[model samples]
Target: MSTTTPDRSYEALSYEWGQPPNGDFQIHLNNGHSVDITENLAAALRDLRHQDPSLAPRPLWADGICINQKDMEERQDQVAMMSDIYRQATRVITYMGTESDNSTGAIAAMELYCEWWNNNGASSRVEMGSFTHEETIAIQKLLSRGWKLLLMCGRRTLAHWSLLSDFVVHIFDGDLKEGGFLLLPQSSHGTDTRAECIYQLALLRHKVQGRTISEECKLSWLLCDFQVFAATQISDKVYSLMSVATDVNIPIDYARSARSVYLDAAKKILANADDFTILHHSFPSQGQYLPSWVPDWSKWHYGTEFVVRCGHLCPSGSTRPSVRVGELENKIDLKGLLVGTVTFLGTPINDHYQRSSNAGERAQWVQQELESIKAHLNGTDPSLLMAECLVGADVFLDVRQRSTIGEGFVAHMKQPEAIIDDVERSLVNSFVTAVRRRSRYSRLAVISGDYVANVPRGTMKGDWVGMMNGGKHLYVLRKTSTEGEFTYVGISYVSGLMQGEILASDSPSEGRWLTLV
Candidate 1:
C-alpha cells in the first residue's frame, strides 16, 4: 500500500471532498474496522465499485479512506507523497460525481468536439455554426463541471486525466473523449464561448506539437493559476500543489499558519526563479499579517487577470536580480532604479467599461477615457500611446492594428452617434477586446515625466514607480515612515518605458537597494 512501492499497481482517485453532510457514511475496511466518510467520497466509492465487473474489487488509493486524517503526522507524511502516488499509479480516475443537468449529453458532445478537433487538426479554426444549439449547451455544462473539478485538483493533475491518461468519467454512464476538451468554462467571471473555443484550439495546438503536460508545471505558474481554488484548510492551497510543481521544495508542516506557509512559498520562489514575475503575483492582503512582497494565496482578489503574455516586456532588461533578505523579519532588499512617480489617475478601465449599459454608452465612455488620456500627452501622439498603454504593449496586436484602433477611438469621439464603416467597426471591436485584456484591478495613471501607465487600483498620486532588477514590469512602491524603506504597492504597466529604455540608459552600478516591507 506504500506509494513508494514501484512494483504495485493501483488506480488513484482524484476528487473533491465536498462539505461533510448532516451524517457521515461508514465503510468497513478489510480489517473489519468501520470508518466514517463524507457523503461525496462515499458516493464516489459506490460508483467506482460498479465500474467494469471484471475490474471490480481492484486495489485503489482514495485519500479519504487510505490516509488517517485524525493523525496530523500521518496526514503530513501522506500529503507529501501525493504527487508521486498519482503519477506512479496505473491510472488516475477522476470521479465527477453522478450525472445531472444532461451530463450524459455533455459527455457525448465533448466526444464529438474531440472527434472534430482530431479530424480538422489544431491549425484549423472551429466554426460555431458547426455545432447545434443543444450541443453548445451540453458542451458548456461539461466545461463548467470540469472547471469546478480543476479548482480542487491542480490543473497539472487534471490535465493528465483529460489529455494523457484519458480517465475523466461521470458516475452513471457515457465516457469522456480521450484528449478531452481543455477549454475555459462559461462563467460569470467574464469568459464566453468564443474565448473557450480559442483556449481549446490553443491546447490542441500544444498537443499537436508534442509538448508534455509536465513541461508547463512550474510552481510559480501553478500558484498563480490555482490561487482561486477552494481549500478548507488554507495551507493546503500551497501544499496540495507541491506534488505537481517542479521548482518548489518547501517542507510540509500542517502546524504552520496559512500566512507562514504562503510567505515561505513566496520567498522560496523569488530566490529560486530567474524572473521576478512572482512579485507581481502578490495582491493586497485580506486581514492577513504578511509582507507586501509575499502573495496571500488564501484570499481571492476579484478581477485579477493572469498576465502570462507580459513576460516579453522587460523594463529592466537582461538585469539579474540583486536581492538579499534584510535584517528586519519580513523585509527584503531589491536593487533597482526609480522609474518615476504617479501624478494623475484615471478611472479603472474595467470598472469604467462595466458601468455602461449599452454599446452607445460604452462607446461614449471609451471616447471620454481616450480624450482624458490625450490631454495628458506632453509631446507623444495620443493615439499611439493610448493604444500601447491599454493593452500593456501586447505583441498579439501589431503596430498597424493598434494605430487603427486608436484612430477609431478618435473618430468615435468626434461623432458619437454616426454609423461607422466596416473597417472602422472592426477596429472598434479590437479596442473592446484590448480593454478586456486589462485587469479589472488596474487603473490608468500618469506618472512623472508625463509617462502613462496601467497601475494597480488604489495607487496614490505620490507613489513611486520602480523598475526592479529581474522584473518583467514596473512596480509601484509607497514610501514607508522609515526614511529608507518602502511598502510594495502593486505591479504597474508604464507605456514607452517597457522596452528596456531606462535600463539601457543607466548603469547597473547606479541602481539603489530598495528595502520593501
Candidate 2:
C-alpha cells in the first residue's frame, strides 16, 4: 500500500463465510480483529446457551443492535465486526419483516438490495470509496499504517452492475425509521428508499463537487440550455412537486389534456436522461407577465421572513429546509411599509398600514444591486427575500386577525434591516456560491415558482418539501465542451432512476407509483 491510502481503492474482496478451520464461519476485520459469525446467528447462540446456560447473552453485533442510529458512532467503530458478525453463526435467522427499513426492524433486505450481499456464506476483501475528501486524505495517510478498505456503498450497485436496464438498491440505510419492534433476528419498519436515495444522492454530490477536469470545459451553456428546453417537450417531465398528503392538485379529466401537453413540452426540453434543474431566479418585471406580488425596497428586509414562512432556517441557526439567513436578525428603525387597511377586534375601527403594496417589490433593490456589480471575479451578490403569510390546508388562511392593527393603532414596520453579502456568505458554503455567483443566474434573486415559470399556481401555498442541506431543489446541468458530458448541481434527484423504480410503498388506488417533487 502507498504511504497514503489511495484516494480510492480498487482491491477485489470476495466473501467466503463458510471457512471451517476453527468453526462454522469466519470474518476478518479491517482492524485486524478476527471473529466468527457462524452458520446461523440465533440457532448458534441458542446452542451455545444450551451447552452452557450462562453462555446465552445476545451479541450486540447481532443484526438486532448493529443498525441502531443511537449507536451510530459505535457503529462506525465496529464496522470491522460485520464480517465476523455474519460469518460465525451456525443458524443465522433471516428476518424479512419490513423490506424497506433499516436493520433494527429489518428481517431481510429488499430484493433490489445489492448483490455484494447475495452470497450467504463468503468472505473476501473489497475496494471502496473514501468516506469523504478529508477521509480520502486521511486514508491515504494511513495507507502505510495498514488501514484496510472493507466497505463502500455504491461500488457494488451502480459501478458494479451498470448493465441492468434498471436497478434500485433499497432498504439498507439505517435511518428514516418508522415505529417497530424487535423479535427473531431483530427488525423494524423503515423506508427502503432512504439508503439508495441517500446513496445515489451522496454520489451525485461527490461527483459534482470533485475538481473539474479542464479538458471538458468547452461546451458553451447555450447548447445545454437548448437541450434542456427541448427535453421538456418529451413524453413526461417532472414539475416541482408539493409533498402535502391531502387534496393535492391532481389533474382532472378535462384538465389532463392541457396539463399533459404542457408537461410533455417541459419533458422534451429536459429528457436528456441526466439530472437537470429549474431556475429559482427572481427578477423584476421585464416581460409582459408580472408576478402576483413584487418586493418593496422602502426598507431593508431581514431573512426571518423565510425562517417562519418556509422554515428555511431553524431557531438554532442550523439550515435544513431553510435557505435564507438573517430571517430573525432585528433592525428596529420602525421603517416604511405598504398601505393597507385592517379592522381591530371588536373595536369597530380600521387603521392604515405602512408595508409595501406588493409582496415581491423587494427584488427591485437586489436587481439594482446586481446590475451595479463590476464583475469582480464573481458576478453578483445576493439578498434575502422575505414574506410572512398564514396559509391553510386546502385553502388560504383568512388574513383578518393577522393583518389587523391594534385597536386602530398603526404599527410602523420595525423589521430588521437587510444586510448585503456575496452569494458566498450564506450559511451553506456549498450552495449560492456556484449557483448564484458562478453561473448564468448570478444576477437574480430567489424568485417564487409562479414568477419563474409564469404559472398561475404561484398563489397556491402548498407545503414545500425543502432540503435539509440548505440546498435548493434547483439543479443546473452544464455540459463540458470537451467530453460532451454534463455537470450539475441543486437538482432534486440526479438520475432518471429513483427509489420508486424498485418498489412503491403507496396504495395503487391513490396515485402514480412514484412522485417527483
Query: Can you write out model 1's per-residue Cα lDDT over 2-76, one digit (the tens) per residue?
Result: 767768789888777887634569888789888888887787777666446875467789988889888999999
Report, for every candidate in turn, its global Cα lDDT versus the true structure. 0.68, 0.23
**Candidate topping TM-score:** 1
What is the Cα-based lDDT of residue 204 in candidate 2?
37
Estimate the lDDT of model 1.
0.68
Note the clash tally of each candidate.
0, 84
**What's model 2's lDDT at 8?**
25
TM-score of 1: 0.82
TM-score of 2: 0.17
For model 2, how does the per-residue alpha-carbon lDDT over 1-517 read when each residue is reduced to its tens digit? 2212334222222221222234555555578975655343333333323344576443323432233324545543333344343344333332211111232111112222234435531343222321223432322222111101112121122233221111122122111111110111111212221222223434433443463644231111122112221121121111111111111222212223433433332233233212122122222221222121111111111221111121121211122221121222210011111111111101000011112122133234323333432132143221111111101100111234223222111111212244424331222112211111122111121222211100111111221212222222222222235342222212221111111221133222222111121
Could you tell me the lDDT of residue 455 within candidate 2? 12
TM-score on alpha carbons, each prediction: 0.82, 0.17
